[model samples]
Target: MSRPRRLLTLGHSYVVGTNRRLARAMAQAGAGEWEVTAAAPAAFPGDLGPITLQPEAGERVVPVSVHGAGRIHTMRYGPELRDLLRQEWDVVHCWEEPFIVSGAQVAAWTPRGAKLVFATFQNLPKRYPPPFSWMERYTMRRADGWIAFGRLVAEVLGARGIYDRRPHRVIAPGVDTTLFRPDRDAGARIRSSLGWMDDAAPVVGYLGRFVPEKGIETLMAALDGCAQPWRALFVGGGPLEAEVRAWAGRYGDRVRIVTGVAHDAVPDFVNAMDLLCAPSRTTRRWHEQLGRMLTEAMACGVPVAGSDSGEIPFVIGDAGLVIPENDVAAWTREIDALLASPQRRADLASRGRARAEAEFALDVVARQHLDFFDNLLMETR
Candidate 1:
């Protein structure tokens, strides 16, 4: 009798819940051939506990601290991650852009006979300082396979002269279709909860960090230009929360700012929105990676409007509106147009839902990941 192939996935983003979704999906797909263990932060983002998505019997979540997203210094994880790497395994997967040194540490511990697969969401190539650059190079060289969220990520790598013979797959991180699908009644329920009863006014949503790179100021400026009736929903927390609150406050009873909603509640927020905006702008430090909210809103059959930053256009793919990055005038025009045209909005909604189902469904990408891992293992054998 042969032992099951062991798969270990390490990430700090597991707190966001999507990582756990992928972990669970992978566990199900690899049932006969593999055993999967996921290692993530003991405390989820916002100091939340373990995810609502409980592990199946025998599958496990090894709680550990994985920090260092914004800090210039390298991240730190517990010793369990280090000791576990010494054991034999078929695959060690690290789901962080190599720019972060923690990924390098994970790759460095890859067992002699095991394969190291690293996933990256960095659409823009970054030039790092000495030790970090060296560590990033080390991790890239060690990877047996690369999974990127978009084609531009590979272009960024190629432009930086980072090359390897190993296979690479451009796969969007999957969204749970069951959790984020369209519901005809969800909008009414959500709107009513927000005291927006019987209001037929257009609702635009922004569901990410209140950070500058998100271009929230531009969104606010565009909304300020609106002459027609429109409501805005802001659903996240970050450094600029105060500014965001003030912006929402100007709208008085029309705007809703929701913080600390569970992952499961995200769909309801999306449903309440007539349009979802991901108006990210490219800065030297960051660009929109996947515009995950765009896809989530799409899954909920809500039309989206994104800026021409990073992979937003690629992800949208004609399903929704794509305006010039940081162009408030363009955002204003598009928002007004979409709000007035019900048929056009419906058309976009239908197309966006189709695109999400086809391109970003959890099971579809999970199978792609399983296939990629299987092929890499086969090649090594």
Candidate 2:
């Protein structure tokens, strides 16, 4: 029997529940044909616990940390990541963007003949200077393949003169269908527990960070023009928490704000919603990469309405309404239309769920990755 091929993945986001689901799904798809080891930070940006893989997942987790969370981000792998690279492997996948110096360092340590794959969600058309640009140049020269989370991201790379230099394709990260699926009973129970049973208003939900780039302000303004009997649920915390709280307070019961919910609990919150809004707007420094919450909401059979910023329209793709970014009137109109037409909302929910199952399901995306890896291996052989 041929020995299984070894695969190493370096990423900080693996500490999140969504990425953990992907790791597990990939392991299941491997079926002894591949061995997967994920190296992750002890804690990610908003992680609540240590990085650890479930025992039965059939994958390994190597804990590593980056330096200076406040500023000057650099991988603190020391000699550990380099030592791991010395071993023979079929592939080394880095989830960080190619411009990131840390991922470039991993490429530097990787041995010859091991395919290096770089994954990125950067949609901003910006250029780096000095050592960072040099690192990006090195990755552009060395990376065997590139996986962009969205088409816009790939376009941004092309604008920066990185495409055609390496083989690349757009492949979104996957979602766990089992975890995010609709459950009316659970939804009802959660709403009842949260004192929402008495409120028959159509609820519009937002689940993500409360920051300027998220366009929460525009959502807030749209909500002000919304008619009575419509409530909004904002679930997340970030720089604009104070502003969000004040806005929610002005609306009283019409706006409910919850901060710092566990990742596992997100599904129940999503299920309680009639529609989810991801009104992200692009700034010079930031844009919506994939607007993952939109997919998660869709997976839970909740219709989504997002602004046409970055990949929101591409991600929604007829599954939900796509409003122009920062256009409060458009957001208001779309929200009102969805709230008034139950049939339209149901249709959108069905389409969104189908889209999630076909494109964002963990198994489906795992197979996509495996196929790409298999192709690369075949070419090498």
Candidate 3:
């Protein structure tokens, strides 16, 4: 009757909606099967809590940070990990950059025969180092496992000698399909709230961190060039607040950029748009992880158009139009095609919804996690 040997999932950015949504999915799916423990980084502004993994069962664990990655952990980085490995978890799952090494370190710290897992939830190519990490090899070196959200990460890890030949799990991160599903009457409410010009004006939208790497400037430039009467909506916030606001100011009434809304409000905003635009650039800083916004938008049955960089091609498959990163001409043409031909947009919407359910639905993604957990544990036994 004891819980199946308490599996611990430690990661940073757990407070973010993307991570929280994923944890909630795992919790709902695993339910009585496993006691899920999650760890997150220090509280930031608007962060709900330091240790939150589904409804405060308090199963969540937030260990102190020691020499952790990022700007804050300048010196004592990777220090607090001793506590994590000392717990001797059955598996250690890390999210994002340094955590792969962090999890690898934890796995190495554990007694022999424990499983190690690390996932790249964000797009890797977007913010890749000048020289990609040979250090990553060392981080994943001792690990016995990996889970990539898309083929992008899968290919990277596979090349690193981490994903091949072993028990590979392809459980992608998911959106809240329940919340993001098509709403026949959502158009009025969202438009009214935003003071948008009736249902006639084509509204292009995006939801993500407001960093320069997101290619928002390119989006703004394209929006200016768009011949058709159009409006663009931007959601979410991040480090590059001043630059984003400055761009929005120039457009005045033409652009409706509402920065920093609650994460839960994303679906409402997403459902209001006719199309989701991700004009991400292939920069030294970021290529994109998986573009969670792309999936979330499609889940609401909205059409999607994005750059062909990173995991977008892997995620969207045949669902939407994929264009070159900085191609304003392509954006203009694609937008024109969708706005002029409702049928094509409808077709993409249908394919997008179907694709979301098949690959990124919370239930589907959660079950995949559980099944992988079961299989990995069985192998261990």
Best by TM-score: 2
On residues 109-178, what C-alpha lDDT tens digit does candidate 1 reach at each position?
7776888888987776567798888887887888888888887887776566454455788889888889
* Cα lDDT listed for each candidate: 0.83, 0.82, 0.69
Preferred candidate (lDDT higher): 1 or 3: 1
For every model shown, what is its TM-score relative to the native structure?
0.91, 0.94, 0.82
Query: Candidate 2 on 69-93: residue-level lDDT in tens?
Result: 3332454455667787888889998
Q: Lowest-scoring 10 consecutive residues by lDDT in candidate 1?
A: 45-54
Reference-based lDDT, residue 122, model 2: 76
lDDT of 3 at 379: 88
Better of 1 and 2 by lDDT: 1
Q: lDDT tens string, model 3, 213-321?
A: 7777777777767777777788877777687778778877656767657667778888888889887777765567788889988898999988988877878889998
- Residue 281 of model 3: what lDDT? 75
